[model samples]
Target: MKESEFIKKNSVFWRKLKKELKRSGPLTCRDTFPDDYEKVCYQIGLSRQRGYNLELIDSLDSLALRMRQELYRKPSLSLHNLLYQFLVETPRVIRGNFSYVLAALFLFTLPAIATYFILLKQPHLAFVLIDPANIEHIEDMYRDNAPHLGAPADVDSRVMMFGYYIKNNIGIDFSCFAGGILVGIGSIFFLVFNGFFLGTIFGHLENQGLGYNLSLFVVSHAPMELMALVFSGAAGMKMGFSFLIPGPYTRLHSLRKSSLIGVKFLILAAIMTFVAAAIEAYWSSLPHLDMQSRVIFSLSNVLLIGAYVGLLGWKRGPI
Candidate 1:
């Protein structure tokens, strides 16, 4: 019960506990954690009761706290865990915020539909929405005899395109998400602008009799690309809405709370964009698949994506 006697009795155990805590790599303390932790808890109580030196008591308290943290800490990341997070947690988050997704879809689609109709009626409007040079370039690319329409021909070219797509897509996603801090006007603007511009291009292509070629080139990746962009816009809007209507929390707290959810959506959007780019660079460009085959493949992609997003994480509960 004397302070000196207590210290002598517990010093060896404390040293061993510290050594175990400092071990590199995976914690090998799991098997003995319960006993060691309980023992430390008891030691701390005894040290206090015996009027031990303040330094000794403080060290015991710190050790006990560290043990508790180590015992309850989250598991380290692994391949399987990462896959589960992507395949499971990501979709769950999306589904939970399906309203935002729907809003994003509408925001992007309505403008596109309107612009498509307008451009279809008057093809010259395409020049207004898109640069004249870019319009010409698109027209040339889809021309019947054009050589490099779908994907680049060489391996290096494909890789370069892939990298380009990743950068471009990520940039767009970041802009859309960051725009939320502006109270969502930026997100809305970018989404509508992009949708209208794209629709104009499609309408112009159709008027020029290149619709089939353009569809063939874009159909394979359109679902993924379009959905990803929508999700990005949705995330931004969600954050913006949080700011506008923070409920009980202060504006700053609401923004922070919404950001947690928004970041997940952004991450999912990036993944989808990466996937779209891969397909665009490789599968979408296969030269051999006719227009019908390409359309079928594209439809299949839509169905697959729908199924994955709708059902992959169902009934699994939260991550």
Candidate 2:
């Protein structure tokens, strides 16, 4: 097309793009800026190739420069924004996808409940679900008036257990998140298996008359750890669902779309697991605290977590 014709055809788009770049605040969708910048570059090239007047060419060059600056500008990082993303945006994402969260909860808890009751009826089932040596070790750890509930009596052992908890918890979280690639079968399997394992352990402790001790050990961090795992499973399920039902887009496109949300879930789950690990290491392992104190502290932590997630981003305007 002739220079004049080309200019007339795209002048409106160029003007709008420039307006967006010059706006006083950050663009709502920074993702579009690259495309706008590329279009401006193309327009500038065309203007120069078509032998447009010096004035028109210079104007296009100036516009292209502004586009480049805006496109390459580094975003300012602020503590407030970081906190808002962690405390608000993360929970908002979870709330928005509550259906998936509910599904994950059901999948994780149902097997636990069933296994708990089944083991209660048949104590020997614990031998089948968990290794006999491990069961014996766990039973000894929580035996009546055991010096330590779950961790060893020395500081080194406590530190080692802390590291182990972090590694184990995060490993489980990653496994649940990565399992989505298998059309969600892996996620389902891990969730169910974990639930059954936990239930078996719980039932075994109860059968051995160590339920109270086990409860005291786990109560503080169980809420965070269990919920984090559920979130991870939920993320995997979301990715798998995208493949199973691509909706209006191709399967690849749908998976890409779902990944944006799945990643947020994974991040939130990681944060929760870290918190749980810290609590388990420092507070839950303290042998000095009485059972009542531990129970109260655990309940308080659960309540605060619930409030933070339920109310932080409720009905707030768009991010």
Candidate 3:
């Protein structure tokens, strides 16, 4: 295309970009900035090749530079940035995949309910999913007067358990996300398996008169850990959905785009999982935290998380 025609074709886009760059959180879609940046760079090259005027070349080059900085500059790790990421960006990303979240919730909750009722009717059925040895261990761990719950009494043991919790939690989260590669079936399986497993444990505990003890131990961390799994399951389903449908783009491109979005979902999942692991290893197992205190803390966390995700996510933040 002639330089004049090319300029005419893209001037509107450039103007929009300029406007967006002036906005507080510039870049309408941060991920899409690369495509826009590359296009601008290509335009600069084309103008130079066509022997366009120096004024126009310089103008395009300047715009390209602005875009490049936006695309590649290291974001500051300021408090404001962190707050915005957690309060605004993370929730926005999650809400965008709300349908997938609903799907994940359905898969998880339904199985849990089913298994819980089934195990209540015949507690022995818990052995189907949980090993007999593990059931015995769980019974001892949640005994009414148990000293440490699942945690050990020593500081070193607690530290080791902290690390182990993080490792184990993250591993589960990664599995929830990576399972999308099996066309979402793997993700579904994992969610159902976990939900059923939990129900099995809960049912068996209640049967053994350890329900209150079990709740006291898990309440502090359950909200965050469950949220993390839900996020990861949604992320997995999203990737699988994109690959399965591919709408307008090629299968590969669709997969690539969804996977990028999935990575953001996993970011939230990882943050929640890490928090849950910390609480489980330390706060949940703390000997001094009474049942009422644990419930209060857990309730506060749930309210905060729900408000942030439900309220902040639904509305645009100042940042």
Which 10-residue window in model 1 sums to the lowest lDDT?
A: 144-153
lDDT of 2 by residue, 162-244 (tens): 89988999999999989976887778888998999989999999988888889988898888999899999998998898898
- Tens-place lDDT per residue, model 1, 1-319, is 7778877887898998899888765454568778889989988887778777899989999998888888887888878888778788778878888898898899899998898899888888888788899899989988877665644478877898899999998799889889877888888888988888888888999999999888878898999899999989998998999999999999999999888888888888898899999989887777777778777877887898788779887766545
All candidates: TM-score: 0.78, 0.75, 0.73
Off by over 4 Å in 1: 1-9, 34-69, 78-89, 121-125, 150-152, 207-209, 248-260, 316-319
Reference-based TM-score, model 3? 0.73
Model 3 per-residue lDDT tens digits across residues 180-249: 8778887888899999988888888988888888998999999999988988999998999899999999
lDDT for each candidate structure: 0.85, 0.84, 0.85
Weakest lDDT window of 10 consecutive positions for candidate 3: 144-153
Estimate the lDDT of model 3.
0.85
